[model samples]
Target: MTTILVTGGTGTLGRHVVERLRQDGGNEVRVLSRSSRPYAVDLRKGGAELDAAVAGVDTIVHCASSPGGGDEQAARNLVAAARRAGVRHLVYISIVGVDRVPLGYYQAKLAVERQIEESGLGWTVLRATQFHDLLVRLFQAMAKLPVMLVPAGVSDQPVDASEVAARLAELALAAPAGRVEDLGGPEVRPLDDLARSYLRATARRRPLIRVPLAGKAYRGFRSGGHLAPEHRVGKGTFDDDLAARFS
Candidate 1:
């Protein structure tokens, strides 16, 4: 049986990946998280526990990440341990436009991608557009105000988290293919429109306004650098997720 370890296995995307692998059967799927027992290890400060977790593992699906900070250090720690354990395959899930987007989190993700490529292990990196769940949380926070403000001219192609997890599981079971095609939702919609949809879904009325921001990052967003229009492989849309969530 192929021994696969999923880092951040209890998280949003990681949990689904773990479930899909288990449902497929025949593979020994292990979870490595700070909270998961028997293998609770923090990649940021990896030590004996992390080494133990990577030991004898054939493939590792790295899904652990922190948007606030410290992702680069975590990637470094994981790479070192994986190399020592002689891991054969390393699969990573990243956001679209990590290279073009100037956001700090995007930069950190790009750094992690480089770390994996140079680690001498068989590796695959898949970049996907923003998840619908992320958008929901963002809108939920923004909707607290009397007027919802969004970045002007910024659009997002939000894909379902489950779909992304499905793709990750498929890749983990196969040989390393290097960087694959980008994945995105069926349609690219503006943030204002999506916020309006969220309001409608929640049955709440709020005034929505688009505020133009200044920054290369905001400009990149306006120019659609974070979008993958040609690779619209995702079927579920933001509205689809909102309906399922609110209904």
Candidate 2:
């Protein structure tokens, strides 16, 4: 059986990946988190504990990420520790348009991708569109205000986290393939419309205003750089996610 370690296995996407892997049965799965026992190791810190967490692990699915920053440093630490442990494969989940989008988080993800590719280890990187949970969180924060202000001309293809998790599990079980095809949601829709839909679903009425922001990152989003129309492999829709969440 392949011994696999999953970083941030308690997180939104990581938990799904762990569940699918466990449900498949046969592999020895381990989760590395600050709160997990024995294997608990913070990816952002390179130390003996992190090294121990990677020992004897054949593959690692790196799902731990921080939008507040420090992801690049975390990747560096993980790569070094994995190398020391003689890990055979490293699987990573990244966001689509990480290279195209100028956001700091995207840039950090892209940097991590580069580190993985050049680490001399067999690696598989899967870049997917934004997840439905992310969108929901965004809308939830926006709804807190009396008036919802959204970015103008911005569209998103929000994929299901479960589907993405299944894909990641499959990849972890297969031979390493460097940089597979991008995965996207079933459809792309404007952010404003989605916000309105969120309001309707939550039974909250709020005035929506679209404000155009001037910036490279905003422009990247407005131009749909994050979209993968050709690889709309995800079958779940935003409405479906809303129904499951709000209902």
Candidate 3:
């Protein structure tokens, strides 16, 4: 049996990946956690434990990232560990508009992408749209404001995290096929509309005001840089998800 290893196995999406492999897939699974008892070994620090943990792994579902955490060291560590372990297939989850946007997170993701590309390992990179929960998290911190500030004329097509998780699992099971098509939600909506929906769900009444933001990230979004117009995943609508969240 091919033992699939999932990095950031305790994260929102990584948790789903591990569950699907163990519960739905019935595959031999190994999860890379910062602190898995019995101490699975620190891949970041690089040692005998890291080598031992990944020794027999056949595939890697790399849902790992350093967003708000690591700059690029996390990915480099994972790649080095995977190479030393001799993994066969490596599936990476990335953002849909990362190539077009100029955010620090995107740059970090790009660094990881390049590392995987040159590694000569059987690798697949799947780019997905922004997750609903990501939006919720962003709004949860700012929804309390009397007025929600958004980038004027920018748009988004937020997809469900669960759906993205499912797709990543699918990729983990399949052969590594270069860069897959972009995956997104059913409908595209303005940032203002998304903020409004978020406020409504949280029982807050706030006005959404759009203002011009200065940055390549803002410009990229304003120029349809975020929406994958051709790659609609159609798994969940934001409105439906809102209801489910409140229900």
Candidate 4:
């Protein structure tokens, strides 16, 4: 059993990956958590603490993200830490169109990828589609009002997080495959339809109103529309994701 280190094992996707590694496959997995007895160390501090924990690990599943922390600093620290430990493979979970789209979260992921590539280490960056829960959460926040206001004229193919995590684990097991194909939902649907579906699922009687936004992020989403409608290899659909919203 190859021993691997998974950052952010306590997070939504990180926890799933850890379970899959232990349950689905016969692999030794260690999570870099902040808690005692389990968490090896913190990567935010250049991974000195994690170095001892990951001394002999074969791979590093870098799921630990700086959601509120700036991406540039976090990515630099992680890459440096991995290099210091001589980790063989680094599997990073990122969103689709991160390079093309100029968003805070996506840009952070892009910076992380660049750091990994520049580190001269084995790496595989899996860019996933938007999680179905994200849209659900968005509607949850917006559906309260009589009008479910959403950005208009945008196409999205939200993929299941489980599928993405499975793929990330598989990629972690394999050799480095730089910049893999974009993973997305089976069908592409408008954002408004997705919002409506969420409302119906939750038995909410809210009408959706499309609102146009003027900005770089909106322009990027409208022009290319961070969607993988052309070559989709995902299995879950919008309804399927809605069925298994959260566990």
TM-score of each: 0.99, 0.98, 0.93, 0.92
Q: What lDDT does candidate 4 reach at residue 102?
A: 83
Total clashes, candidate 2? Answer: 0
The C-alpha lDDT values of all candidates are 0.94, 0.93, 0.80, 0.80
Model 2: clashing residue pairs?
none
Which 10 successive residues of model 3 have the least lDDT summed? 37-46
* TM-score order of candidates, top first: 1, 2, 3, 4
For model 4, the local distance difference test gives 0.80
Indicate the worst ten consecutive residues by lDDT in candidate 1. Answer: 182-191
- Looking at model 4, report the run of 10 residues with the lowest lDDT sum: 36-45
Where is model 3 more than 4 Å wrong at Cα? 38-44, 69-71
**What lDDT does model 1 reach?**
0.94
| lDDT at position 192, candidate 4 | 88
Q: Write the per-residue lDDT of candidate 3 for residues 5-27, one digit (tens) a residue.
A: 88878887888888887876568
Model 4 residue pairs with clashes: none
- TM-score, structure 2 vs. true: 0.98
